[model samples]
Structure formats: C-alpha cells, structure tokens
Target chain A: MQTVIDAHNISKVYNPDTIPVHAVNSVHLHLNRGEFTALVGPSGSGKTTLLNIIGGLDAPTEGQVVINGINISELKPNQLINFRLHNIGFVFQAFNLIPVLTASENVEFIMLLQKRPKAERTRRVHELLASVGLSDKLNVRPSQLSGGQQQRVAVARALASRPQFILADEPTANLDSHSAATLLDIMEKMNREEAITFLFSTHDQRVIDRARRVITLVDGRIENDSAATQIRH
Target chain B: MLLKLAWRNIWRNRNRSLITMSAIASAVLLAVATVSLQQGVWEHLIKNLVSLYTGYAQVHAKGYWDEQTLENSFEIDKTVEQQVAGTPGVNAIAHRLESFALASSGDKTRGCLVVGINPAEEENLTRLSAKIQSGSMLESGQDGALVAEGLAEKLNLALGDTLVLLTQGYYGSTAAMKTPIRGLLHFGSPELNNQIAYIPIQLAQYWLDAPDRATSLVVGLEQAEDLPAVARSLKKSLPKTYEALTWKEMMPEINQHIEADSAGMYIMLGVLYMLISFGIFSTLLMMLAERQREFGMLNALGMQPWSIARVVLAETVFLTLCGSLAGLLLSYPLVWYLAENPIQLGGDMAEIYEKFGFEAIFPATVKAKIFVEQTLVVLSVGLVLAVYPVWRVLRLNAVEAMRN
Candidate 1:
C-alpha cells in the first residue's frame, strides 16, 4: 500500500519557556492509502494534537511530517496551507460547516477553492451529497439542519476536494448513539468502496470497534498499535 | 462567489448592517446639506457684492489698478470693444471713466467717486436701471447723471437739479461738468450709497478733455464660473499693455473672508470625518470579532487570507454605496425645497446681517458637484477604514482564531 502520511518523531510542547507542557511527545506514525484507522485515547492523551501536527494545522516542535512525499513542516505557512488543502481533509468536533452556505454550496466550497471546472464541481457536489444520504437536504443551511445532518454535510464537504486522506477529530462525540452508528457506517462504506483513507481520533467505543486498525495513546505516547503488532513484529 | 458570500454575510446580521449603513447615510446627508448651504450663502454674498458695482471681471490698462490716476486710462475704440465683446462667455462690457471729484449743490459740497458710464451698457452689465429709487434711468448720450440716494441727500439735490463735478482731468487738465441728475440710485452697501455718482461716458470724456478714453471696462459674464477662463482669455487676447481682473482680485477682502470662513468650516468637517471613520471602524471591529471562527474555518478550507479580505472589502463597498445613494436621494428634495424657499432670519439676526450689507436669508444650493464631492469623501473614509479588516485577516492565526 502507498504511504499517504509519514510523521516521524513529532513533538508539540506548549509554553516551553515558562512551564513546558508536552502535548504530543516524540510520536512517530504512518498512514497508508485506503486505511480506516482510529487513534483512541483517554482525555489529555494528545490524540488531537498529534492529528493536528500530521494534518499541518499546527507545527510540531521537534520533527517533520511528510504527506504525499513532501515535508510539510519545512514549508512556509502559506505553502503549508496550500499543501494541506490539496492533500488533507479535516472534520472538527463541532461540525464546522460554513453556516451561510447551503449543504450543496458547503460541499462545493472546497472544490471552488480548488478551482475545478463548473460541470465537474456540480457533478461531484451532487454525488458527494447523495453518497452521504443528503440528496434532499442540498438546499438546507446548517442552522436549519439537525446536528447529525450537519455532520453528514461536513463529511461530504471533507471529501469534495478529493483529498488523499481525511483526519476526523471526535467526529461522533457530539452525536447520539444511532446518529453515531449511521455516520460510522457511512464512513466505513466510503473507505471500503471508494478506497479513501480516514484517520480519526476518538474516545468512542463504536468508532474504535469499527476502525480496522486501532492505535491506543496513553499520556502523549502510543501504548499499543494493532497494525504495527500484526505486520511489523 | 466572494461577492455572493459578502452579500449574504451582511444580511446575516441585518440589524447590524442597517445600523452601519444608517451611520454612513447620516454622514452623507449632513455633509451634503451643510456644504450646499455654505456654498449657497457664499455665492449669494459674492453676487450681491459684485453685482452692486464691480462686474464679474474687469479689464484695464496693465498698470492701472496699482496707480489710480487719470494718466493710467486707456482709449476705448471699436476694435477694443469688439474684441472684448467677441470673447466667449463675455455677455456684455460697460465702459467707465472713474475718478475722484468734489460734488456741490447749493452750499452742500462733498467728495465723491465719479463714474462715467455708457447708460445702455451699464444697464446690461450691472442692472443699474433696477436700482433707480426715483425718476427714470439714464438715456444713451444724454448729458445727465445718476446720484446715489445718500449722496443726493447729503448734497440736498433732487431730480432735474444740476450738480457741479470738478476734478483734475487727463494730463492735469481742468475737468468740470454741470450735469442734471436724472435718477437717484439705491445701494445695499453704505459706502457705495454714500459717495458714488454716475454720469454719461460721452459727457464725462468730453468734460475731462480725454475723448474716447475709459478708466476701466467691466466685463459681465453669462455664468459666474466662467470668470477665470474668461479673464485668462481676455488677458491673452488683449494687448500686452492691458490686463483682465476677476472680481476676487479687484476686491480681495471678500476672498479673504471666504477663505477664513472655509478654514473654520474645514475644521468642523474634519471632526465630522473623524466621527465617520470611528463609526465605520467600530462596526468593522465588531464584525471581525463576530466572524473570527468563520474566517478561521475559511482559511483552513484553503481560502487565501487576501480572498477573505476581499469579501470584507466588498461588503464595505456595498454598504457605503447603498448608504451614500440613499442619503443623496433623501437630501435632494430637502435641498430643492430649501433653495426654493430660503430660511429667513428674524429680529436681531436680520438686523445683524443688514448691518453687514447682507440679506438675512439662508438658502441651500442643489449642485451635482456638492453631491459627488460629499459622496466621494464618505466613500473614501469607508474604504480607508476597510483596510483594518484586511490587515486583521492577513495576520490571522487560524488555529487561535478557530479556538475563539
């Protein structure tokens, strides 16, 4: 399998001078294409920080993150933002969809930023929204939609740019059990059918159970890795 | 898409948007009305002062204004008169041979300004016929004089009475005339009413023994704004020994007064602009604060910082333009009404204005230039304030902003 993300010796420290707090301490991880993986941890275990470093949203204090054969840590801020736009998709815990746009426009916004042709963007927007089972909710804004439906729209928006992988931080934390199961089913189906990679940081047991490979983090360190245990040693 | 986004964003908080727009509109309305009234009053003053005696522009020998002696007078011939009359924007020209002289009736002798005028041309240039208090306007080539009412009173003279005028003429020649008073003229200005006397140009020139010579040729203009261009053209077309002078140059105290008033007006306008700037800036600051997370999300979604700034700038442009247009629409009728029906001062205010030789009425002017100028000024203030949002967006830290 092609390696989509390769993060090596990544460390992020907050307030290093006055009171150094190691958010993510010397973590090394790799994500391959089409992989459905979850980074599971208790509270304060640095799952989100590690994900942010790998997604190039925040800079790592110590090491480098390579995505699609380019070292993102060495890129300038503007260049790093561009690189992430082309390679990574992010879903926040709060379902951060632009409230002013309808579901269709929210999904199409990424493609618009990519400067895709109009016909292709239109076709892909329809396909993505339909794939998320939101074909009827295309014209509905986020304020008018339920939390689960808004998250589904956010998922479609994440896939609109055709990114190499998607990083979801607590995607199911804000949903009820039934909504969470439905969202996980949709994500798993997309992973299986479309061969899209997804890396999620979650404390939910359902997400951990559904993920094909689970990496457990304890206090900013990777305590156990299911894929590493099975393949590497 | 940016424009669409900006348009939607403004309406998202409809009240906030309306408030900001109202502020801009109020600024424009106040500015336009204030400036229109100021310009109207100034124009009225200038018209009253210039039309009373000095025409919009005057032509004389090159060095005549500096030395007011009879030796500085120029000969008025058919060619000079035709050349001045043929200039564009030159409506009419009044030839005058002006000098200081002693006027006497019966035992009442007083020093006065003697002006020799072509009765017909002076009528067209200064509307001298309109100011006649009694008797009739002077006829062309009639050997008669028009005495100002105050001067006539002081000299105890009446219509059909002969007044003696004695002065040193051209080249120290004895200039003397005894002309019958055809009319008594009233003037708003006390100085002009007190000492001015007008006689026929032919009789004055013949009495002064300088035939066909005039001390000044006051040129009337079709439009007051054409003064500068007409003066420049007259100067260029006339001989090198002649100069054309606008009324502002002939009477600089009026210009000085206007400039001083404008300085005070500009200081007030500056304060108004500062208030406008703060009003816009505060609204923008609130907008930025409210949309911090959305801006961060957009940045994370791959929209460039400059693109977000463009959207904000576009929003500002729309708000300012709408507000300014609304202000213009609202102010037009008010200005037109005020111009048609001027506000009249009462009691002490009327007396004060009259003491300064001005009418005690305040009118507004409806000028396209005023509207455009005020709108551009408000728009510029708005656009300059918009730079703050662009700067904030460019320096935004997406991670921190998203936390907010």
Candidate 2:
C-alpha cells in the first residue's frame, strides 16, 4: 500500500523556556492509503496532540510530518493551511459544521474553498451526502439536525475536497450508542468502498473495535502498535 | 463565498448586529444634523450681513479702502462696467461714491457716512428697497436722499424732511447740500443704522465736484461659492490701478470669528468620532470573541487568515453602510423640516443676536455634500476600527482558539 502519511520523531512541547510540558514526545508513525486506524489512549495521553501534529493543525517542535511527499512541518502557516485544504480533512469531537450553512452547503463549502466548479461541487456534494445517507437533509441547518446527522454531514464535508486522508478526533464522543454505531457503519462503508484513509484518535471502545488496526499511546508516547512488526519506543 | 459567509455571520447574532448598527446610525445622524445646523447658521448670517449692505465682492482703487478721502476714488468708464457685468458669475454691480460728512437738521447735527448709489443697481445688488421703513424707494436720477432710521431719529428728521450734509469735496473743494430725505431705511446693525445717508450717484458726484467718480463697485454673485473665483477673475480682468476683494478679505474680523468657531466645532466633532470609534471597536471585539472557535475551524479547514480577515472586514463594511443609509434616511426629513420651520429664540438670546447683526433663529441645511461627507467619515471610522479584528485573525492559533 502507498504510504499517505509519514511522521518521524514528532514532539510538541507547550512551553520550552519556562515550565516545559511535553504534550507529544518524539512520536514516530506511518499511515497508508485506504486504512481505518485508531489511535487510542487515556485522557491526557497526547493522542489528540499527535493527531493535530499529523493533521497539520499544530506544528511539531522536534520532527517532520510528511504528507503525500511534502514536509508539512516545514511549511509556513498559510502554506500549511493550503496544503491541509488540498490534502487533509478534519472532523472535530463537536461535529464542527458551520452553524449557519445548511447540510448541502456545509458539504459544498470545502469544494468551494478548493475552487472547484459549481457543477462538480454540486455533483460531489450530492454523492457524498447520499453515501452518508443524508440525502433528505440537504437544506437543514446543523442546529436543526440531530447530533448523529450533523456528524454525518461533517464526514461528507471531510470527503468533499477529495483529500488524501481524513483525521477525526473523538468524533463519536458526543453521540449515543446507536448513533455512534450508525456513524461507524457509514465510515466503514466509505473506507471499504472508496478506499479512503481514516485516522481517528478515540477513547471509545466501539471505535477501537471497528478500527482495523489500533495504536495505543501512554503519557505522550506510543506504547503499542497492533500493525507494527515490532514495538516502537 | 466569503461575502455570503460574512453576511450570514452578522445576522447570526441579529440583536448584537442591530445594536451595533444603531450606534453607528445615531452617530451619523447627530453628526449630520449638528454640521447642517452649524453651516446653516453661518450661511444665514453671511446672507443677512452681505444683503444688508456689503455685496459678496467689492472692486475699488488700489488704495481706496485704506484711505477714506475723495482723492482715492476711481472713475468707472462704460468699458469697465460692461466687463464687470459680463463676468461669468457676476449677478449685479452697484457703484458707490462714499464720504464722511456732517448732517445738520434744525440744530441736530451729527457725523454721518454719505453713500452715492445708482438706484436700480443698488436695488438689484442689496435689495435696498426692501429695507425701507418709511417713505418711498428712490427712483433712478432722483435728487432725494434715503436716511437711516436711527440717523433720522437722531437728527429729529422724518420722511420728506430736508437734511443738510456738509463735507470737503475732491481736491479741497467745498461739498455741501440740502436734500430732501426720500426714505427711512431700517438696518439690523445699530452701527449702520446710526451712520448711513444714501443719495443718488449723480447728485453726490455734483455735490462732491468729482464727476463720474466711484469709491467702490460692489459686486454680487449668483452663489456664495463663486465669490473667490469671481473676485480673482475681476482682479485679473480689471485695470492695474484697481483691486477686487471677496467679503472675507474685506471683513477679516468676521472671517476670524468663523474660523475660531469652526475650530471649536471640530474639537467637539473629534470627541464624537472617538466615541463612535469605541462603539465600533467594542462590537468588533464581541464578534471576534463569539466566533473564535469558528475562525479556528475555518483556519484548520484551509481558509487563510487574510481571507477570514476579509470576511470580517466585509461584515464591518456592510454594517456601516446599512447604518449610514439609515442615518441619512432619518436625518433628511428632520433637517428639511428644521430648514423649512426654523427654531426661533426669544428673550435675551434674540437681543444678543440682534445686537451682533444676526438673526436669533436656528436652521438646518439639506446639502447632498453634507450627507456624502458624514457617511464617508462614519464609513472610514468603521473601516479603521476593523483593523483590530483583522490583526487578531492574522495572529490566531487554531489549536488554542479551537480549545477556547
């Protein structure tokens, strides 16, 4: 499989000069195309920090994160944002769909930022919403939708720009069991059918069970890798 | 897309947006109304003062204004008169041969200013006929004099009474006459009312033994704004021995008073603008605080910081534009009403204003320039205040902001 993300010795320290606290420490990881992976840890185990560094949302102080052969760690803030727009997708724990935009508009927004043609954006938005089973909720705003439905819209938005991978940080944390299961089913369907990579940081057992591979983190460092032939220090 | 986002974002907090817009609208209304009234009062004062006697512009011999003697007077030939009449903005020109004289009527003798005027031209230039309190207006080529009401009362002379004027003529000649008072002219200024004595130009020329000589040619303009250009053109077109001056140049005291009053008004306006700035800045701060997470999410989703700033700036522009439009809509009718039905002052205020030769009424002007100027100023203040949000967005950290 083609390696879509390659993170080497990544470390994120909150404050280096005074009262330094290591949020992520010398973490090395790799993710391949079409993989459904879960990064699992207890609270404050640096899972979200590592996910942020990998998703280009936060810069790692010690190492490089190369996504699709470009070292995003070395990119400027604007360039990093551009690279993320064209390459990475994100789903926050709160299902961060724009509150004002409707379901279809929320999904179409990413493609608009990518400067895609209207016809193409419309077609892709319809396809992605249908794939996530939200075809009837096109005009409904996030405030009018259920927690599970908003998350599905977020998923469609993530896939709207045709990025190399999607980064979801505890996406099911705010959902009920049935809604979480439904979301997992849709994500699994997309992962299998479209061959899209998904990397999620979660404390939820359902997500870990559904993920094909699991990586465990403890105290700002990776302690176990289910897919690695040998353990990483 | 950014514009749509900005438009939607502003309406998301409708009450906050409305409050902010209201503040801006109120500021614009107050500013426009205040400036309109100030300008209106000054315009009315100038119109009254100029129309009472002095025209908008004056032409004289180079040293005529400096020296009051008959030797400084100039002769106005037909060519010079035609040239002045043909000037673009010159509405009317009235010639005056002015001198100081002693008026004696039945043992009531007083020092007075003797002004010679062409009846038709003076009527057209200053509407002198409108100021008549008693008797009839002077006819062209008439030999009668128009005495000031106060001067008439001081000399104990009524209309149709004969008044004696005594003065030295040109080249040390004796100038004396006993002319019948044709009218009693009332003036707003006590000084002018107490000292003026008007006679026909031909009669004054004969009395002073200086034929065809005029001390000043008062020029009226079609509009007040044309004063400077008309004065300049007159100066350039006239002979080298003559100079043309605008009313402001001839009456520097009034000009200085207006300048000082304008400076005080500007300081007040500056304070008003500062308050307006704070109002706008507070709104911006609230908007940024409320949308911190959304901005972070947008940054994480691939929108550039400058793009986010542009959206915020667009929001401010829209709010300010809407507010300014509202202000203009509300102020226009109020100003128009005030202009049509001016506010009258009674009692001591009226007395003080009358003492200074100005009316005590307050009015507002409805000029398109005032609307455009106040709107632009409010818009500029809003845009300047928008810098705060833009700067904040530029330095935003997605991780921390999202956490907040």
Candidate 3:
C-alpha cells in the first residue's frame, strides 16, 4: 500500500525552556492509502495535536511530518497552504460550516479556492450533496440546518476537493447515537466505494468499534494498536 | 463567490452593518456639505472682490503697480489690443486711467481715486451699470462723473451736483475740472466706496492731456478658473514694459486670509475623519470577534491568510461603497436646495459679514469635485480601518482561534 502519511519522532513541546509540557513526545506513525484509522486517546492525550501536525495545521518542535512523500514541516507557510488545499480535507467536531453560505455553497467553497472549472464545481456540488443526503437542504444556511445535517454538509465539503485523505477530529463526538450511526454509515460507504482514506481522532467507543484499525494514545504516546486490523482494507 | 460571501456576511449582523454604514454615510454627507458651503462662500466673496474694481486679471505698465501715476500709463495701441484680444480666455477688457484727485463740494474736501473708463466695455466687464444706487449709469462720451456712494456722502454731493476735481495730470500738468455727478454707484467695500470716482475715458484723457493712454486693462474671463492661464498667456505675449497679474497676485492678503482660515477647517476635517475611522474600526473589531471561529475554520481548511484578508477587505469595500454612494446621492438635492435658497445669516454674524463687504448667507456649491473628493476620503477611511482586521486574520492561529 502507498504511504499517505509518514510521521517520525514528532514532538511538540509548549514553553520548552520553562515548565515544559510535552504535548506530543517523539511519536511515530504511518497512515497508508485507502485506510480508515482512528487516533483514540483520553482528553489531553495529544491525539488532536498529533492530527493537527499531520494535517499541517501545526508544526512540531522536533522531527518531521511527511504527507504524500513531502515533508510538510520543511514547507513554507504559503507552500503548506497550497499543499493542504490540494491534498487535505478537514472536519471539525463542531461541524464548522460557514454561517453565511448555503449548504451547497459551503461544499463548493473548497473547489472555488482550488480554481476548478465552474461546470465541474456545479456537477460535483450536486453529486456530493446528494450523496450526503443534503440535496433538499442545498440552499439552506448552517443556522437553518440540524447539527447532523450540517456535519454531513461538512463531510461533503471535505470530499469536494478529492483530497488524498480526510482528517476528521472527533467526527461523531457531538452527535447522538442515531445521527452518529447514520454519519458512520455514509462515511463507511464513501470509504468503501471510492477508496478515499479517512483519519479520525475520537474517544468514542462506537467510533473505535467501526474503525478497521485504531491507535490508542495515553500521556502523549501511543499505548496500543489493534493488531488484528493492522492491514489496510 | 468571495463577494457573495462578504455580502451575505455583512447582512448576517444586519443591525451592526447598518450602524457602521450610517456612521460612514453621515460623515460623508456632513463633509460634502461643509466643503460645498465653504467653497461657495469663498467663490462668492472672490467674485464680489474681483468685480469690485480689479477684474480676474489686470495688464498694467511694468512699474504701474508699484507707482500709481499718470507717467506710468501706457498707450492703448493696436498691437496691445490685438495681443490681449487674441488670448483665448479673455472675455472682455475694460481700460482705466487711475489717478489720485481731491474732490470738494461746498465745505467737504476728500482725496479719492479717479478712474477713467470706457463706459460700455466697463459695463460689460464688471456689470458697473447694475451697481447704480441713485441717478443713471455713465454714458459713453458723457462729460459727467460717477461718484461712489461713500465718496458722494463724504463730499455731501447729490445727483446733478457740481463736484470739483483737482489733481496733477501727465508731465507735471495741473488738472482742474468741474463736472456733474451723473450717478451714485454702490460699493460693497467701504474703502473702495470712500475713494473711487469714475469718469469717461475720452473726457479723462482730455482733462489729463494724456491722449490714447490708459493706466491698466482689466481682463475678465468666462470662468474664474481660467484667470491664471489667461494671465500667463498675456504675460508671455506682452512686451517687457507690461505686466499681466491675476487676482491672486493682485491680492495676496486674500490668499493669506483663506489659508489662515482653512487651517482650522482642515483640523476639524481631520478630527471628523478620525472619528469616522474609529467608527468603522469598532464595527470591524466587533465583527472579527464574533467570527473568530469561522475565520479559524477557514484558516484550517487551507484558505490562505491573504485570501481571508481579501474577503474581509471586500466586505469593508462593499460597506464603504454603499455608504459613500448613498451619501453622495443624498447630498445632491440637499446641496442644490441650499444653493438655490441660501441660508441667511442674522445677528452678529450678519453684522460681521456686512462689515467685510460680503452678503451674510451660507450657500452650498453643487460641484463634481466635492462629491468625488468626499467619497474618496470616506472610502479611504474605510480601507485604512480595514487594515486592523486584515492584520488580525493574517496572523490568526487556527487552533487558538477555534477553541471558543
């Protein structure tokens, strides 16, 4: 399997010289193509921090985070932004849909920034929103949509750029059982049908149960990996 | 899409947006109105002053401005007339022969400026015929003299009264004459009114024994703005013996006076603009605070800081444009109304204006530059205030910004 991400000895130290707090200490990890993996840990266990570094939203104090054979730590700010636009997608726990944009416009924003053709953007927006069961809510603003529906629109937005992988930080933490289950079903179907990789950080047991592989962290270090689901699907 | 998002975002907090827009609009409207009135008053004062005696420009013997005497008067030859006439902006030229003379009627004797003019040309240039307070305008080839109202009052002379004028003429010649007061001309300026007397040019030449000679040619232009250009052209074409001077050169005191007065107005405008900038900045700061998480999400989603800044700037520009355009549209009718029917001054202000020989009224000018300049100034304030929010976005830390 092609390696999508290769992070080696990544350490993030806050206030290194005085009362240093090791947020993520010398953590090594790899995520291969076509894999649905979860980074599970308790609150403040550096799962979100590691995900942030892997997604290039942050920089580590030591070592490098390599995504698709390019060391993102070495890239300039502008280059990293361009790389992320082309290759990475993000889903915040809050379903951070732009309040002003309609559901479809939220999804279309990434492609717009990517400078995609207008026809292709329109086609993909329709297909993606329809696939996420938000076709009826395409013209609705985030304030007018339910939490579950808004999250689904966020998912569609993450997929609009056709990135190498999607980083979902606590994707189902805020949802109830039914909505979480429904969101999982859509994400599972997309992963299985389109072979799009998904990396999520969650403490939810339900989210852990569905992931093919899970890496559990404690005290900013990985404590367990489910050996039975080590192979990429 | 960027513009659409910006537009929608502003309307999301409609009340806040409206407040900001109102602030900008009010500032622009007030600024436009204030400048319009200032320019109107200044133009009116300048027109009154220029037409009082000196036209928009004057052509005199090179040394005549320094020494007002019959020896410095130049002959109105064909070359000089043609050169002055060929100048593009020169609408009309009124020739004058000016000298100091003592007038006595019965008991009172006063020194006054005696000006000889071609009645028809003078009337065309300065509208001298319209200034007649009592009696009739001076006719061409009339042997009568027109005394200014103040001068006539001082000399205690009425219409058709014999006023004696005694003065030295060309080449040390003693000039003495008696003529009837043909008209009493009203002068806005007390000094000019107290010291001016007009007689026909031919009669003046005959009395002074200076044939075909005039002290200066007062040149009027179609528009006041053309005064400088016409003066420059005339100066270039005129002989070294002649000097063409615009009203600005002829009246440095007025320029200095305007400059001194404008310093205070500019300070007031500066304070107004500062308040306007603060109003806009407060709105931006509030909006930014409200949308911290949204900006963070955008930042995390691979949207460049520059892109986010562009969106914020777009919002600012939209608001600024809306406010400025509305203000500009609203100002036209308001200015027009004020200009058509000026605000009359009363009380002490009216007394002061009258003392300066000006009408006591506030009028607004309906000029394109007032609108364009005020719009630019207000828009620039918006753009300048936008920098604070743009800087906030440029340095945004997504993790921290998203925390709340």
| TM-score for chain B of all predictions | 0.90, 0.93, 0.93
Interface root-mean-square deviation of model 3 in angstroms is: 0.8
TM-score, model 2 to reference: 0.93
lDDT of 2 by residue, B2-119 (tens): 7888888889989988987888888888888888998888887777677556789888889877776889999877888889888999999999999999999998899999999999
Candidate with top lDDT is 2
Interface RMSD for all numbered candidates: 1.1, 0.8, 0.8
Give, for candidate 1 chain B, the lowest lDDT window spanning 10 residues: B44-53
Give me the overall lDDT of model 2: 0.89
A1-233, model 2: which lDDT tens digit per residue?
89999999999998799999998888999999999999988999999999999988888889999998999978988889999899999998999899989999999998998899999999998999999899999999999999999999999999998999999999999999999999999999989998999999998888888888889999899888895223222
Instruction: Compose the digit string of candidate 1's lDDT tens values, residues B1-404.
Output: 77878888888888877887888888888888888888888887777678657888888988898898889999886788899999999999999999999999889899999998998899888888888989888887788999999899999999889999999989797778899999999886666888999988888888888888998998888998888889889888888888888889988988998899888888888888898788788888988999999898788777789889999999888888888998898888888888999888889988787777677778888899999998998888889999989999999877888889
Work out the TM-score per prediction.
0.90, 0.93, 0.94
Fnat for the candidates in order = 0.44, 0.83, 0.66
Arrange candidates, best DockQ first: 2, 3, 1
Query: How many clashes in each structure?
Result: 0, 0, 0
| Candidate number with the higher TM-score (1 or 2) | 2
Q: Give candidate 3 misplaced runs (Cα > 4 Å).
A: A227-233, B133-136, B153-162, B187-195
Clash-forming residue pairs, model 1: none
Each candidate's DockQ score against the native complex? 0.58, 0.79, 0.73
